[model samples]
Target chain A: MVTNEDAARLITAIKTSSTYDFTDYSDKSFCRRIEKILLDNNMDLNQLIHKIGKDKDFLEQMVKDITVNTTELFRNPEMWQTLRYHILPKFKKNRSIFIWHAGCSSGQEIYSMLILLNELGMFDQAKVFATDINTDMLEAAKAGQYKYRFNLGYLDNFDKVIKENPFNFEDKVDVPYEKYFDIDKVKDTIQMKPFLREKAVFRKHDLVKDGNVFYSKFDLIFCRNVIIYFNNKLQSRVIDMFNSSLNRDGYLILGSHESILGASANNFERSKGFYKKKQM
Target chain B: MNDYKAIMIGGSAGSFQVVSRIIAALPANYPLPILMCLHRLKHIRSGFVEALSIKSKLPIIEPHDKEPLKAGRIYLAPANYHMYIELGNRFSLSTEDVVNHSRPSIDLSFFSASYNFKKKLVGIILSGANKDGALGLKSVTDNGGLTIVQDPKECQVPTMTTASMNATKVDYVFSTKQIIDFLLKLA
Candidate 1:
């Protein structure tokens, strides 16, 4: 029911009421989050305009609500399998491989990559730069403890990836998946291996505002699922940022369902699930 | 279901055949966006969409995060995530935790659609082993949306349909063939 005029008005109201500027964020997802807040609070648009001015807590909650910091370990195992067999091994040839897991939700993908690298016996040479805009999620990622059960299917994907004959080298290295986790008997959840947790460094950075991450080009950058919460313009901008951020021939892994369509498709050469920035 | 913007139908175990039946009946230019969530294996991604599209006339898409919801198309909730509707008629997916042990959860999508679409939602719950969509169908009714539950007698698994009937007063109860016929009228 919201029109462009209403969205512009809401943006004005939010900017006037709070210090944060949401004008650059995707309007579609932004409106949805606002609508959710309206529904949860049982308030209409007019009431929302008034409440944001009068109530500070509502403004704070709205920021947290809009930032989607939800992800699972190996969320899409096929993507991770690509990382395991195809991507990570390519990076292994380098003495010290650097990775940036932009918008790493709860460090699931980070840990997944680390475990894969560990299995390949190259984890010691890799450093994972995992960061998020949300501090709460960043802390969770740093903690590297998960309450959810590590699904057996996640392990199954690892096995399938090992069997895929990675790098076409003909020799496949096998590792037991259970060794990566230390069972928490009381909580009934799994905490990732301590050795892997030490390798991932978590930080807080907004993908929209942060111009450069770490000021060093990375061998591989994972910006999966993160770009989908954006409009075409923002998506293109982020993809360009990622393209520049990667070293030549470096890979960019997106979500399984996400593709670099339209203008963004030109930034990288597609190889099925993998997108490699062209060597200039 | 007057002036309906979207049609949401969700199901679980034993629901594939029912979903295929509905899709086979929908024409190429069905007016409203049809979103579906069927419980599936978490790791298997590619085959399901291809399987669903085999007999469907409408172009079936597994929505990327924040993809705009469009008319005359069908959207499937992808694996290992719960798809939600934003007020502006776009899709948002979250992977907080699996609900009712099912990602791409039926209830999560239904409840969100109920809130977003409100009076414009047509919610349907079909054959399944669990009670995932029961409360969601209730939410559809609460928000003045239409609710349909497959007849338990005709369901491959009746736990979900029976639970849905027990949860709230639904607007319609029909067999698979009758459900297809009803959807045909809307198309």
Candidate 2:
């Protein structure tokens, strides 16, 4: 059992040795992650304290483990379909649309949005801001490459999205996923096309920290599946940031599972599971 | 048993119908809060709570993080997130990598609730294909909580029950009918 003092010392050591401050994260989950790190290394708290400064990769790896959860391409396809059909089409006529993919871990959501934009013929009009706190994830996102093989469910979702593509049924605008990716047999990865890579700027930013949002106003913000670890107070702070970051009537898309009921969010309107910032 | 504040039940494939039936058996005002962690598909949003609620006497909820766990309610692990109880009866969620090949692993919830609720919980293992709930049941027993397993013969998939039995000494083994009776008696 890890004592509060042990957790405190660990937090202090981590903050002193690194740029990440997880003080605002939920205490139990944070402490559990510390325990996991210790268990993974077969080291006691004192050894972990010693390792904080000596091992250059240790703290980085620990933060990465705690923060980077599984993300998928075209995750929760119906939500994407809603965005494609109802929300994003309005942005087609706007001049220079700015979109932020907050906590865009491994860049799947970023690429997914880009794919939609290209299909909608709005790719060139969009300037994408993709950010994550994990340096390693941001580096991977910068490369714009992913595994050639995707989850079968992902393919299933793609198929459903196309079959359910009610907006362009007559036009038959297709999602040519293969066109954006080519197989690298030796590397076992798919290289995202160079053209799509040019549209987005990647950065490392913490969601909990103020002034870390890339732009003051966004036409749309996609911050999905990133806030579950946060306690209610932190969640409210992040939502407030999202509410402020969005432009008038701009969309804030959360994960399918996230419920927005707890937050005041009085300035946001629900439009097909996506929240729109009201012009208050 | 009146002092027991919470009940935790876990399972994977083929557990849903059983879970619903058990919920149907319990009263609307069942005194103990029920915490359940069942393996579910990650890609799609589930209507699991609503589906289970159709037959349940009590309200079924997909609890959010830091929410207080209330008695006479059923709290389910949301799709793709592991569920844990913070030390003070507030729920916490984690997106940590799936354990035992399942997010919302039975073991994760059982361990946490056992650590906190201690002898005040009744941890149960039901129908599942994987061995996810076995170690969790062990944790409950270690914490002096009562343990129950659905008998393998009655399970749609017996692997989970057999695994639980192999992991620790389960207090009672009941078929679906017997389990329903047990819940009714508790009510």
Instruction: Residues A1-280, candidate 2: write the lDDT tens digits.
Output: 5754687788788888887777667766677778787898899999988887788687778888778457877877878888888888888899878899888988878887887788778988898898888888988887877765654455566565644575666655456667776667677677789887777998888887755456358888888877766767777888888887777878888875564646556778877779888876
Candidate 2 lDDT by residue in tens digits, B1-187: 4578789999888888889889888887788888999988775456777788899888888887677889899999988778889877988777777789998778989988998899988998999999999999999999999999998988899999999999999999998788878766765
The i-RMS of every model, in angstroms, reads: 3.6, 2.0
What value does the TM-score of chain B take for model 2? Answer: 0.96
Question: How much of the true contact map at the interface does candidate 2 reproduce, as a fraction?
Answer: 0.42
Residue-wise lDDT of candidate 1 within B129-185, one digit each (tens)? 998999888889999999899998888899998998999999999988888887777
**Could you give me the TM-score of model 2 versus the true structure?**
0.91
Model number 2 iRMSD: 2.0
List TM-scores for all candidates, in order. Answer: 0.78, 0.91
Model 1 chain A lowest lDDT segment of ten: A148-157
TM-score of chain A of each: 0.85, 0.87
Give lDDT for model 2: 0.81
lDDT, model 1, position B112 = 80
Candidate closest to the true structure, highest DockQ: 2
